[model samples]
Each structure stands twice: as structure tokens, then as C-alpha cells.
Target: MTGHSAVGWVDIVVILGYLLTTVYLGWLGYQRTRTGADYLVGGRSVHPIIMAVSYGATFISTAAIVGFGGVAGLFGMSLLWLTFLNIGVGILLAFTLLGEPTRRLGHHLGAHTFPELLGARYQSKGIQIFAGLLIFVFMPLYSAAVMTGGAVFAATQFDVDFEVALLVFALITAAYVIPGGLKAVMYTDTFQGLIMILAMAYLLLFAYTSLGGVSAAHQYLTGMADLVPAPLQAMGHQGWTAMPKFGWGATGYDLWWTVITAIILGVGIGVVAQPQLVVRFMTVRSRRELDRAVPIGAVFILFMTGTPFAVGSLSNAWFAQHGPLLKGQVVKEIDAERGHALVGLMKETSPGRWEPVINPKTNQPATAPMVVVAHQPAQDGQGAPVDLVSGRAPTVVYAKGDADQIIPTFINTALPRWFGLVFFLALLAAAMSTMSSQFHTIGTAAGRDLYERITGKHGTEPSVLAMRIAIVIGLLVSVSISYNVREEYVIARFTAIFFGLCAATFLPAYVGGLFWRRATRVGALASMTVGMLVSLFWLLLVKAKEASAIGLVQLVTGGKTSLLADYPNWPSVDPIIIALPLAMLTLILVSAVTKPSDPQHLRRCFPQYAAPQATTL
Candidate 1:
């Protein structure tokens, strides 16, 4: 636990080599890509395995490995459920249910982008253009969160400035992605995905071996139940073994509501409609390839998502055993701001709850340790914040209380230097792979879907150039937003927010358009609008993190609580749970009452009915 661990020259050389290889792949992609279709959808020729890996890599970025992994450290093994859902919903159902038809119709309509596909499906320019606008606007927030996660890890590992790491990341990613487009992005993603898989495999082995084994680690964590932070215990944390009880637990309904609704259902169900992930459905040659990809994607998701939660939870055990390593963590500003030096010398002035931390030596609050803390909204038997207000709390302080650093800190302190470097490359790969896709999606959405639709003009060369410009704009916007965000958890929250938003705004129309022939333009439009707006309102005014940051809820209520104060757990309810159902209901009601789309349009969109055999012979 020194000030900073030095990266080896060999490690530096390896990273440089990886970057050069990525650039070379991009050049290859650029050579292959002649038209907008090749750039956007890889000419619908991406191999199933490559497509599957690229999709998983894009789906699970550093946000999953670093941000959400850190959450696993705090929340425990319950996150494993998300991994299962990822396989079931994100990969299996998405591919089996949506992928084939999307690919068929997308190819049939010559729709190069996701928004364009939707527009062609519904025959509505507004749906296509507005979808593009949403991508241009909200996608940056997600891209920024991905950038922040990678930048934080890179800065910590390389001992470089955050801005420096971010700039280098942007440059390296933009170099390949801006020029080569989706083909290049996928090629590199395939490579990065392999690296990620290897690194995670090794990470899992190391994590378990370091703790004696999987069983041993779990046993140790279970034995150390007394060490589960008091606030967490109050919130129904049951060590690293079991799921928090659904209801009537010691931790009560708050933790249950938050975990089930926001983290689990929000992200789990949301992945089905994620544009970046969904776009992969169109990357391959046919439904057969999409079907072939399911197993590959399942394994990839299993390893990437499963390993992190397992390793992250076990790291809590490692940190508990080795307190000194905590000092090496890069203390986030939020944690630093909350730190206080005071350690009160209680003289048993009361029978239960003691006074706040105060230095007896100076008769005032000390400022050296700079203690930063948050309390769970729960009171102990004595009516005080479990251990935060003092009563048999551990005296030793971690450098940062922010849970987001858990994985990075563990990697830096616990892993071998060379392995850590390999892991860094893996993380960099994860971030860049996802970021490139995000930027590429943004480029295509804005350039092809929005700008071209707005002008009612389209051409390959001009559209390519416009997308390249859009890529640059996307990089700038995401980087700027990255600088403003400071919280570690917010990185994960942003992903959830975007996922929920995508689910709300896109899922209903997307499903209906692909299946039901009755879905009309008005219904689709209304669903998108209502779902998008409701999600925005919930995130900005109901959720604690964004709501507090925006301060709109505070302004209106003089409290952090959401608009639905009648329900105690309203704030914990994820927007997706609320907005997605409303969207579906609207889509159904409006489509039912208004008018069905033209039969010709349906016949064209669903070619199964108009097969060669159906031709009047």
C-alpha cells in the first residue's frame, strides 16, 4: 500500500501493442467498409461468434466490472441474479424473440440504423427522427459514465491525471471508431471481448485462490457477519451468501424495494431494449447466425457478469482481513468531503445512544481524518444511526467509504503487478469497446436517423462524413459530462437510468412493431413520448441521487422524497417498473382504439406472410 504502485515497462509495451493492434483492425475495417451500410451494420456479415462477443462486450462495460461490481461488494451476492437475467432476457429472449425479425425487416427495408429500422417499421419519420434525437441527447450521459469508470481505473493504475487518462481514452477510441465505424468497432470488440474473458477468468481464479477457495471465502464472509456494517445490517444485508429477504426482514422493505425494483428488475428487464445491444441483432447475416450466437453470448455474459459479483463480494473479505490495503484507494471527492477527524471519547453520559464524534483532547470536532459518511434511514434500538452515531463501531477508517472503489482498490492492492496490468488492459478494452459502440450508435442515430431524416436527403459518402463529425461531437459531449460527475455509484446509476429509459421508451413499440400488425403510428408515438417523459420525471424528481443533484424535488417539497409520498417505498421503485407498463398500456389502448396500420405496410414489414410461395401463381 504505497502512494502509487509503479507499472512495469513491459506492461506499458503490452498496452501500446494492444492499441496499435486496435488501430490496425480499424484500418482493416475502413478498407472493407465502402458504403454507409457496411459502416453501420458490417454489411450484415458479422460472424455469429464475433457478433455475440461484441454484443456482450458492449453490454457489460467497465460500468459493469467496476461500478456495479463495487455495488456487489456493498450489496453482496444478490447481484448474481442480474447475471442470470442477463442471459435469460438480454441474450436468449432478445435474440430468439427480436433478433431474427429485426434483421429480416431491417435488411428488407434497407434500414441501416436502429431508429431507421423503427421508422421504416412504423413508416413514421417522426418516430425515426425523434428516436435519433433521444439517442443524441441521453446517450451521452451513459457514454460519460462509461468514460468516468475507465478514466478512474486508468488514472489510479497508471498514476496519471484523470483528464490525461480520459483524453488518451477518447483519442484511442475515436481513432478507430470514427473512421472504421461498426465493422471496426466489432473487430476490436471481438478482440477486446477475448481479452476481457481471459482477464476475468484469471481474476476469478486469483480471487478464489487468494481466499483459500470459493467455499472458504463464503465461509469466512459468513463467519464475519458481525463485521457487516451496522447500517447495512439494518438494511437487511445477510452477509455474502443469501438474498435479502423480500419482506418482513430485519432490514425491512427499503432494501428489498431498492434491490428488487431498481437494481434487479430495472436493469434486468431494461437490457431487452438497449439500442446498443439491440443493434447487434442487425449486425449478423441472418436469423440462423443470431440463433447461433445465443450460447456464445450466454457464456460470455455468465463469465463477465458472474465473476465480477463473486470477486467483488469476496474482496470485502480480503479488505476486512487486510485493513492496511484500504489506504491505497483513490479517495473520491465525495468521500473526502465527508471525512472528519473527530473520535469522541465517550464517558457513558447516556445509557444507549452517545453524542456525535468530538475530540476530547481539544473539546471540539477534529478535522484530520476527514470522516465522510452516510447513514441508512434506520434507527437502532437506542434510536441512533446504527454505528455511525457511535456505539461499538470499529475505530479504523478506510481511505474512502465510497463502495465504487472496492474492485479497483482490490485489484491494485491484492493482484500481482503484471496481472493487474493485464486486468487494466482488459478493463480498458471493456470501456473502449462499449464507448466505441456508444459513439458509433450516436453517430449513426444522429447522422443517418436524425439529420438525414430532417433534410430528407441521404447518400453514403456524405452520411459517413456526417457520422464521423457526429462521433467527434459525441466524444466531446461525453468527456465534458464525465468531468462534472464525481460520485462512484452514479456511474452505475447512469447505466441503470439509460437502461430503464430505453426499456420505457422503446420496448413497447419495438415489440409491437416486430409482432403485432395492429400497432399504429399514433400508438407508437404516444408510447415513446409518455414512456420517455415519465422516466425522465421519475429519474429527475423521484430517485434520490439524480433528484438531489437536480434539486427540483427538493425545491418543490423541501425534502428529498419523491412526488409519490403516499407510498413509503415510492422513491425506491424504478422508473422502468412504472413507465414500461404504462407505455405498453398506452400502446395497446391507443393502437386498439385509433387505427391499425395499412395492410401493405404490415405485409412489407412482416415478409413471412408475403413469401415467394404466397405469390399468385
Candidate 2:
């Protein structure tokens, strides 16, 4: 911890190796792609297992690793509930209920993009156009969020410039993606998935071992919890294993209400709405293949989400005995036990058992014992520690209020230099693999819906070239937003927002056009229009704090909250909550008021989905 190894030759070797391996895989995929269909949908020949990995990788992004994992660090293991939600709602329900039907419909319609499926099923150009435009706009915002997360983590860990890291990420990802297309993306996603699983396992075992197994670490944290000083301890502070008791109860119910609802529903329902992800279903050969792939995707999602949640929970103890800068902030940066927890865990666990070697300057083991001086005596009711904060011992777990960079900070500190290199390579792979999928999905949205269908015949080879060009255009635009824009948005936050809009607008219309026999073109249009507009309005008005805080006058009269609160603003009600309901109501009532889609057409549109699920949610 004292004299850490700056990233050296081994680290550079590890990164370069990953880059070469990725670029080569992309080239191999390109060699396999011969036609537009092959390139766009992997020739509809991609094995179900490969397709499942592609789907899993896209879902488990930098947002999962860096952003949400860090969130777990502050919020505690309670956030681990998301793992169940991912496997249960996102994977199980999504695959068993939605996957086969979507696959059958896509094959029946010969669909390439999500927009095309909507257009083909109902025979409506407007629906196609509307869906295309939605992808063109919203998908980029999501891409930018992922890019920003990769850039920030790279800069913090590798000593690279932030913007430079971002641009490098953009360029390298584009190189492999555009040249090879979906096949390349899937191959690379599969490889990256394997590395991610192994790296996380290694880190988990190392963390527990370094902390003197689970029991010793728990004891150390509990002892430290007893030593927290007063005043500081009055605020929320507790050990890693214990649920925090800051009057907010175990999970801080109010905040948890919003987070759990947002994420569980966001991811659970959101997985269905993702245009990019859904298109992958079009490539599967059969319902059998989809069935075969389900277990693979489920296991991957479980490990990817579960590993990070576990690591983040113990991060408090990891950093305490290793690095305790605290940055001299007024609110003490971290709660007494939360801040100290991580380092203390490391102190108890590490293999190169910590010894106070003489500092040469003072000789005689420097000033004092490393662990004892930092030992902090037990605390009383107010939780004061004499040495660390108050007279009493600190809590076992502590929270660093701000959450942007804590997880990466500890990994960079605790792991051996070589392990850090592997992790960096693994993270970079996460961003690149997912970005490739994003680019492919967006390109397909343009190529099939806007370019091919409208013209009757597809655009010439040049039109296909234009699709490739659009990928660059999309990446540039998303990168611009990632670099220059300063918005108050989290990756998952926007994902849920946009997803709710898609579900409200598309789910009912898509279903009705295929099975209900009650959906009309007019109603579909109304649903999409209302759903999109209401979502945007809510985001702009209700979601932003100042707009809500000041009410109507302040919102209209040049809002003052942006500069004062530095919120950069947020859109309201998270779109899905309200906009979706409105969209569904508009679709249903409008269908009833007017004419239903042709019954013959409805049967052709969905034979399987209309047969019905065994039960309702």
C-alpha cells in the first residue's frame, strides 16, 4: 500500500495482448460475413449460444461494473437484490415468455431491425419511421453514458488523459465493429465474457483471503465500529455485515424504494424494450435454439452482476488500512466506519502480511505501529473513537458520500500490478464489445427501415456503405455528448427512462397488431406520439429538482436551480412510470373507438404469442 507499483511493462503487455486478440477476432468475423444479410444479422446462422453471449454482454456493460458496483459500495449489500431481479425478471421471464414469440414473429416477417418488424406486421410505414427515429435518438444517449464510464475509469487507473482515453476507446471500438459487423461483435463479446468471469472470481477470493477470511474481517470491523467517536457517529455509520441504522432503517427505505423500483423494473422490463438487443433475436434459427441458449445467458448475467455486488459490499473494509486520504472534506468525506472499513479489511487479509519495517529516516520502525496507531479505541453510545474521530471505536463499515470513483480506486490500490492490468483489459473489453453491438443495432435500424423499405428495393451497395458511415456519425455524436456535455444523468437512470417509453409505446401496439385484432394504424401512431411526448415533458419538468422545487413560475422564468444547485438538470417521472400507462390507454381506447387491425392479418402476425402464456404477471 505504501509504495505501490505504478503500472509497468507487464501491464502494458497485458493490454496490448487483449487489443490484438480482439482486432484479430473481428477480422475473422468479417471473413465469414459475405452478404448484407450475413453482415447485418450474422447470416441468421449465429449459434444460439453465441447470440446469448452477445445479448448478455450488451446488458452487462461498464455501467454495471464501474457505476452500479460503486453504488453498491456506498449503499451496502442490500443492493445485491438486483442480482435476483436480473436473473428472475430480466432473464427468466424475458426468455421464457418473450423470446420465442419475438423470434417467431421476426422470422415470419423476415425482419432485420425492430422498426422493420413493426412496419411489416401492421403494414404501416409510419410505425416503421417512428420506431427508426426513436432508435436514432435515444440509443446514442445510452452509448454516450457507457463511453463516459469507460473513459473516467481508464483515466483514474492508467494515468491516461481522460478525453484521450475516451477518444481511443471510440476509435479502436469502431475499427473492429464497422469492418466485421454483428458477427465480429458477438465473437468478441463471447471472449470478453470469459475473461470477465475469471477476473472477478480471482478478485473475490483475493479480497476475502487478504482480510483474514470472513470471520476475522468481521470481528475487526465490529471492533472498529465500537470505537467511532461521537458527533461523527451520530450520522449514519455501521459495519459491513450489519444493516445501517441511520433512522432510515436497514436499507434507507425511501431511497431504496426509488432505486429498486427504477432498476428492477428498469432492467426487468427494460430488457424487452431495448431495440438493439431485441434485433438479435431475429438471427436465431428456431425456438429450439432460443431454448438452448436460455441457460447460458442466465448464468452469465448472474455471475457478472453477483460478483461486482459482492466486491462493492466489502470495499469499505478494503480501503481503510490501505489508503485513508478522506480529501479533507467538511462532511468527513466518508462516515467513520464506512471510510475505514475497506483498508482495515485489507490490513487483516493481505498475503504479504503487513509489517512495520523501519523507515530508514526514523529507523526503529518509523513513528509507530501501522495497525495499532490506526487501531482507534472502542466507542460509546454516540460512537466516538479517541484516535480516529471521537473517543469511541468506529463502525465496521463506512460510506464515502460521493460515489464516482471509489471502486476503481481500491482495485488499482489492492491488486498486484499484473492483476490490475488484466482488470483494465477486461473493462476495456466490456466497453468495446457492448459498443459494437450498439453500433450494429443502430446501423440496422437505418439500413433496413429507412433505406431499404422506403425505396421498395434496397439502396445499392453505396446505401450499405452509408449504413457503415452512419455508425461513425452515431459514434461521433455520442462521443461529443460524452465529452462536452455535463448532464445530471446515470447510465441506468436514462436506460430505465427510455425503456419505459419504448414499452408503453411499442409493447401494446406490437401485441395488438399481431394478436388482439383491436389495434389500428391510427391508434398505434397515437400511442407512439403520446408516449414519446409525455416522456420528454416529464423529464424536462418534473424530474429536475429546481423545476419541481420552485414550481411553474421558476420553470418558465429562466430556472435558477441549474447554476445554484449545479444539478445540470434532470427530466421527470422516469418516463416509464407515467408515459407508458398513458401510451397503453391511448392504444387500447383508440382501438376500441375506431377500427381494429384486420383479423386475418393479426393471425398471420402472431400465431404463437396469441396462443397465450400459461399465467399472467
Candidate 3:
């Protein structure tokens, strides 16, 4: 069989079983869900274990696996720090500092959605409507990015069309989420999370075993430091083994900033304020459930996030050892044209062919270069061998430059077929879990939060129907976006952009509302407005991706500049680094000058403050 063969019947049966089970559980959840509360927050009765797995499953999606996995393949093991930050900041600190209070406040205030919580806390309809609008408008970008990650991986690995892959995912997620609501979403997530945990564990072990164990892999990769591309080296990539040096000095500042600020800090800090994740805190019964959820969430994050980064980086070493040899015809061509300017030196000179390489140390060409060619075997009797060879191409592999293809290629070429099928299922789970949550969140913001706030209606029936409609609309928008932004790198960056915007726009006000009684309505509104705008401006004008995509930067600068066009060039920096502090400062400064929030309101918001204090004994 060819290396890129379709999955076997055994694999197809396994995948079909997974889908049927997910749909069946979703139907069960739908049967139990009757009220808006049950639909939006799982009636706030979800178990701690289920809540933890659901949160982690929603948090780490195709974006983490297929998107950032590609980044790990390019940038190396530095991505592991992101995994640590995810566990430490995203889970541990997020639960300790934010979870319990969010639950209490959400319950006390009768806030099922994030915007409802903000609106009720600040006593402003404007804030509530605006918050909901921000989510409805910007969240599709993130959903699209995640969709692209999974679609691309499926297309590359399975030989399926990308459009078909996207359609299947959208349909499957909508099937469960629209009818079953958050309860169904959680149930499906729990199952998906189990698959992810198992898939990642097996993949990590397979990676190590294929590379002759962990230490040998590291040693081999370190020795191949010379193979680090010139462009990457110029940008301060020392090797895959070491951390990139920080700051704008002899070491490349661009690499440092991209790794540290754009990825690590952006995703890490952003997780605390993520509306989807924050709402997960409100899903469980009490502080005890949330407390129970912490360690499971941590371990799940460790496996799902850490495994991919390690596996992706180590794939580089595996390719170095087992990749293809040069074809004889191409080697002859290179020899014949040795003194002339070589065209497509590294590229295939002919289809399914490549040239010989000169010995790097000796600077001399080798004779009898290894190449795979079809030849007839000697017949023992009157019988003759078949005219063609149809087995796998053992020496036809090459280093893949497309970062998005790295993990998918490795799975297909370096692992057993059953393992490939299992990993594909895991990726499908990642995508569906995340997209379901995102679609549900978007729907809630639009239908329950915005529609009710705008219409001044409190009917439960219409609100639920509106939310279901919004889910359909959200899926359509996200699919359109996924089609438009097809490049994996760009899709991955959009994920970061959404995270950065969330941090900038929501983190300061959300945190302050929980802690500081002095925070004012005007302060919260201003922080949200300024933070979101600044983050968008940075992405659409200052950063190259959206700037080039929109061309606004070119028009404003008369084709000569951008917001950062004349500024010193450094690593790609996430807007969160600049916008988050500014948002906090705006909140604090505005609150300091404005009238204090109503004492009654403050008392209502902070239940702990309302509790009678014991007199000193």
C-alpha cells in the first residue's frame, strides 16, 4: 500500500462508533434539558469531574493541537513553557482567584451569561449589551481558526477535501449543541476529553520509542544545529534544544517577542478571562466542585497540551533519521550541471525525484547515491515476476517545510495505521468540543444577552429559541471565515489575536469588579471600550497579518507605512502586553475620579461584605 492510503475498515468502524456514541449521549442530555438555565449552564448541577474535563476539552482544541503543534515543529521545545503556563496560570490560578467568586456572583445576581453578569454587576444595560456585542462580533474569528486547524489536519492526513471536512465538523457539532445545549456539550466533552488524554499518552510514547528513547533524540537534534535554517538562525534560533534569548540585543528580539509575548503570555493570561471558560465555573454546584476540579484540569491540560509540543519538536529528529534518499536520475542531473547555477536545488528536479548531496564535511560528491527504483526480481522457475512494484516507498520521504503538515505527516508516515486512526479521532474530538462551546457561547451572548437586553423581554421560551437560531448563524459565519483564511499560520495567529483581545477588553474590569468595591460603571465601560479598540488597531494596522489582509494600513500610510511601519522592527508582540495594563490603568484612573458605586449595589455584589462581621473578643 502507498504511504498515503485511506484508513482501513477497522479504523472506519472505530470512528463511526465514536460519532454514534457522542450523538446518543447528546440526545440523552437534550431529553433532560428543559429550561434556559439548564441549556446555558447545565442547571448549575454538573459534577466536578465532568466540569473539569469539559473546561479542559473546550480550552485545548485543534488550535492547541494542530495550530500550535505546527508552531512547535518550527520553533522547537520552547513551546513547553506554554504548557506549564497553561497549567499554572490558566487552571490553578484561574480557579483559585476567579472561579469561586464568579460562581457566587453569577448565582447571587441571576447571571447565566457573562454579559448578564457584567451588566448586573455594573448596573448598566449599556455595558451588558456592549459586552454581548463584542463577543458576538469577534468570537467567530476564533471559531474559524479552530475549524481551520482541524479541517486542514483531516484533509492532509485522510486525503479528504478540506471543504468536506469543514462541513462534516459543522454539522456534527450543531447536531448535538443546538438541541442538547450546554448539558449535551459537557457530556460530549467528557467523552472527547477521555479520547484526547489516551491519544496524547500513546503518541508521546510512540515518539520516544521511534527516536530510540528521549535522551538519544535530544542528542541527535542538538547535533543537527547546523541544519537550522538560515532565516531562523538570523532571527535568533540557537537550536531546538535551548530557549531563545530575550530582548533586542545580539540575540534576535523578534523570536523572543513572538514566543514570549504573542504565544505564551497571550494564551496564558487570556485564559482567566475567557468567557467560555469563566462560564464553566458557573456550571457546577458550588466552590467545593470547583475546588475538586483543579487537579484533574491540570493533569488533562498537561497531557493534551504538553504531549503535542514534545511530539512535534521530536518529529524533527525522527525525520532527520528516516527521511528519503535522493533519486538516481536527479543525482545524475546535478552532477551533469554541477558548475552551472542550480535551479530548484532543494526542490524536486522531477516529480517523485531529487538529486544527490555533496558530503558536507568533505565537500565532495558521493558515488552510487541510494535511490529506490522498480526492478524485476530473479524467477526461480518458469514463472516471471509482475511488471510493477506496488509496495510502500521506503526511501521517498523528504523534510516537509509546511509547518501545518508536520504532525499530520508524522502520524501517517512514522506510526502504525491503527495509531493514526486513533489520533485522527482525537483531533476530531478536539475540534468538535471547542467549536461546540464557542458556538454555544456566541449564541447565548447574541440571543439571551443581547436580544433580551435590546427587546426588554423576559420570556424564557423566545430566548431559548433565539439562542438556538443564533447557533446556526454562528456556525455559518465561522465556516465562512475558515474558508477565507485557509493558511494555518494565519488561522493560528487569529486564535492568539482573539485571546489577546479577550485579555485586554475583559480581564481588568472583570478582576476589579470581583475585588474592588470602588470600581465604577464608567470605569468598566471605558476599560472595555479602550481595551478592545486598541487590541484591534494593533492587529489590523500594526501587525502584518490583518494589516495585509485588510489593506487599511496601506491606505492610511499612502503605501509607505503602517502603525508600526516606521517603528523599530522586533518580534511579533501580542496586543495584550500593551493593552491589558492600559485597560487596568483606565479602570483604576476612571474609578478614582468618578463617583463610587452605590453602597447598596456594592453590598449586593459582594455578599461576603454583607455578611455580619464578628465583634472582636
Candidate 4:
């Protein structure tokens, strides 16, 4: 197999044309904007289709397609469970159970942001301020993850520097979001969602067809169970077509815990509390619109998440059949500074195709390929590297297959050149749609929720201007993180961190405020604070993946990867598993004892229920 070339002039022209169209749509949204409400929530009059597509687009970003899709490449089709949860929980349950109440509450209280909704319901400015700070501070980590996914693919497809791609991507998104606000964000999201559907549908069809259909692909992938990397097998990997070994109180349950607790439940449940997604509930004028949107959003999520997972897993079979083989000698060197062994030798002749490096002076391939594998430390801290394929000490690693690069490599090498241009645009759309919403949410959290509440200045124009400025600041923060964060396969990890944090901190309080009339201001505040603190404590001290990446645990413990490193399977458990239940328990216990909110405020928030009860009496 040969390498894919950098995008050609025709591709460049098509991309520029797409950008111009997006600019025109942004201008249309800007023309429609009139007041603070218009800027924050599209004047609460968005069409059902537009609202649904915007919600799905905001929910499914490059993080889903590139990040988690790459994860699917490493882990297997077991990721399909996440796609099921995305539709069942994220779309159906969210829209049916929570959407109407949130919309009614936001409308009745005149709340434009998620923090404002919580603050207004609880009648506590402190809650608003704290939530706003949380969002402004941590959301950048997730934004940077999304930005990294887009920049990685762009860098691969266009053959540009990753930093250059990230900067350009951020600037392009800021151009539309700062001025057009929610209106432009939704309009552009609708357009982008359409592109995503088309691209994913094509990719899914092509993957199965190229692999001799569904059964053939799965059968072949199942047959390659022996090809599972030795290290992965040691960690309980069964095969690409089957679930990881599942058990508790044992060492080999690491993969099972990671898959269930971190990947599936963390992201699946966390989507319900995402500020950007919740705000979309308030975009439409009525509950009827939400009902109309349910099916559209469900179908959109299915294509958005399902296609990527399926295609990502199928790529393993495609690569095994057609990918370039490594032919080289083994060489290993220990790097003392990073504490990892540099092993293997190979060179990329194209995006996904690897071969021996060519000697420029001699115009011939090197006698031995020098493949630079990602840094993976020995389990014993001995600085000995294991071969990815054979799981042997001090052997040649064949391919530079980072989990983050799997989807991009497959797209570039396995698909047709024309499809590359289409997928690039689709990925750009995925990144831009989500980034615009994120920047918008972060700005509102800073300007409308934090700054206005702090200064006691509620004028519409001032709030709008402050939000625009905050959007630029947020962009800078996310861009800087994207440029500087050096963790490998970080897209999925950072995404899970943000999502799990939001769920643990905000989900209990937000749900309580909507349904439990007796939920007190103190209870909401306490639940949020405890949830945030516990989640952070767990991430920095106990969760092995995040703890090691953060290095805070190592710094405090003098080289321990986690506080519970010796405890079996504890380090692999997601923070959400521990923190969310505690947070909910706190909310329930505290609310049961504290004074209930004012009856009149509850009446206004739940007017539909209030009238029914009043009539019955």
C-alpha cells in the first residue's frame, strides 16, 4: 500500500467555498440578532429542525468521531454501546423527560445560560458565580481536546503543522461565534450537521462494501483475536469483535473497568448535564418543538456516533489485509529524562503507509527502518519497552499506531481521494459546530452569568459586548492548551474528564432544581461544591489515567501513579462512578433537611404542574 498525497488545488478550492458559505450564514444570523435574548438564545424562536440539528451537532464533535473513533480502533466494536446510550439517553430520555421542564423554567425565569437557570431556581448568586467559574476554567480542557482532534486530521490531510492547523481552526470558529452568537451557531450547526450525516452515511456504506459486507468484516476481525497486542491481551483484551474480559478484584480487569466506567458511562451519562447542550432546550419556543425534534436528533446521533465506531473497528481488518508491513531490525535505547524506551524503526511514506526511511544523499531506503513509537513506560518502572505486536521485551515495534491517529490514518489510506476531501469538510464541520457552541457557552458563563452578576449590571448591550470579548479570550485559552498539551491520545481522555466532571458537579443539582420543589438553595450549593471537589480529588489522586497525566499524585506521593496504586482495579475506575452517587446522595440528604424554596418561585418554575394541582384542589 502507498501513501495518500496532500490535498490538491481542487480540494483547497472546495474548502474555501465551504468557508465562504459559512460566512454568509453567519452574516444572516448577525442580521437577525436584535437584543440580549437574541444573542443568547436565538430569541427563543428557532425551528424544530434547526434546533434538533444544532443540539446533535453540539453533542457530537470531533471528539466523538476522531477521538472516540480512534479509541474504537484500539479497543473494538464494544464502543457501539456508547452509540446506543447516545441515542437512548442523550436524545430520547433527555428530550422527553428533561427538555420541557428545562425549557419552561428557562422561559419563565428569563434565564439564558445554564448557570443562570441554576442560580435563578435556587435564588443564590453564589451558585451562579461558582458554576460560571467552573465552566470558564475547565471547559477549555474539553475545547482543547476537540480542537486537537480537528487539528490532527487537518494536519494529516493537508500536510501542515499541527500548531498551524489548530490556530487556523480556532480563528475560523471565532469569526462566526463572537458576532453571531447562538443564532449563527445554530444556523452553522444545522449546515454542518447535514454534511456530517452525508459523510458518515457514505463512510459506513463504503467500509462494509470494501470489507465484503458486515458478516465478512466481523468474522475476519473475530478471526484476528490472535493478533491482539500482547500487552492488551494481558490487560484482558479478547478481540475486536468481543467485549474485554470482565471481572472485579483482579489485575486483568483494567480494560473492562476502563470501557464500562470511563468510556461508556462517563460520556453516556455526562451528556445530560453539558451546559452547551442544555441551553439548546431553551432555544425553541415550545415543548411541541422538542417533541418534534426527538426523532431527528436520535437519527442524527445514530449516524454521528455509530458510523465512526463501526468504521474505526473495521479499519483493523482493512489494515491487516492491505497496510504496509514493517521489515526492519530491532534497536532500543532508554531515555532517562522521560523514563521510557525508544524502540522500533519505520517511516511514513504517506499519511498511514509506513516503510523504511529514505536516505536523501543516496536516494535509497535505509538498511534498517527507524520507527519512533509513542512513549509507553514499563510496568516495573525499569525503562524497558515492549513490542506493540509481540509484547516481547526489546523487540521492534512495527507501526506508529497511536490511538488518536487510527481514524485519520484509515481515512487517508483506505478511502478514495475524493472521499478524503468530503471527510475533511465533515470533520471541519464537526469541530467548528461544537467549538462555536463551546465558545458561546463559555462566554455567556463569563459575561452574563459571572461578570454581570458580580457587577450588578444587567444591560443587554453591555452583556452582549462583554460576551463577545469573553469569547475571544476563551478562544485564546483553548488554542493555547491545544498547542501546549503533550499527552498522547489526549482527545478522548480530556473529553471524558470534562464530561464526567460536569455530570458529577451539575447533574444532581440541575435535575433537582427541575423536579424537586423542596430542593433548597443550600442543598444545591452544597451538592455542586462537594461534587466538584470530590471529582477533582479523585482525578488528581486516585484515577490512574488522569492522575499520571496530571502528575499531581506523583508530585505528592513521590512517584506513585495513583493514591490507590496497590489496590486492584481501583485506579481504573472513573471519577463519575464515585463522585456522582455521592453528589446525588448529598443533594438528597441536604435537601431533606434544609428549608424548601419559596412556593411562589416553585409555582412560576413549574406553572404547568402548578395549575393542574390548583384545579384539583
Stretches off by above 4 angstroms in model 3 are 249-251, 324-400, 460-462, 611-617
For every model shown, what is its TM-score relative to the native structure?
0.87, 0.79, 0.88, 0.89
Best by lDDT: 4
| lDDT of each candidate versus the true structure | 0.78, 0.64, 0.78, 0.84
The 10 consecutive residues of candidate 2 with the worst lDDT sum are 361-370
lDDT per residue, candidate 4, 251-284, as tens digits?
7889999999999999999999999999999999
Q: How far does residue 560 in candidate 4 sit from its true spot (Å)?
A: 1.0
For residue 51, model 2's alpha carbon misses the true position, in angstroms, by 1.3
Model 2 scores a TM of 0.79
Please write out the lDDT profile of model 2 over residues 1-617, one tens digit for every residue.
23233567767777888889999999998898777767777777789888888888888777777666766665556556778877876677767777777777877877767787888776799889889878877787778767877776677576566688889999989988888888888899989888887887787788778778878655655555553333223433343344444233322233433445455555566667777777777778887887888899988888778777767656656655443322111112234434433122112125534433222111222221111223343222232222332333433333223333545656765677677667777678778878888887777777666666566666432255757877887888889877764333354454556566677667767656545656788888888888888766655565543244436635564654322223321231245677777888998888779876776677777664456649878
lDDT, candidate 1, equals: 0.78
Which TM-score value belongs to model 3? 0.88
Pull out the clashing pairs in model 1.
236-251, 338-371, 338-372, 339-370, 339-371, 339-372, 340-370, 340-371
> Positional deviation of 330 in candidate 1, in angstroms?
16
Model 1 ranges off by over 4 Å: 248-251, 322-400, 460-462, 611-617
Residue-by-residue lDDT tens digits, candidate 1, 207-263:
888778888888987775544554666767676667765673232556667777777
Between candidates 2 and 3, the TM-score winner:
3
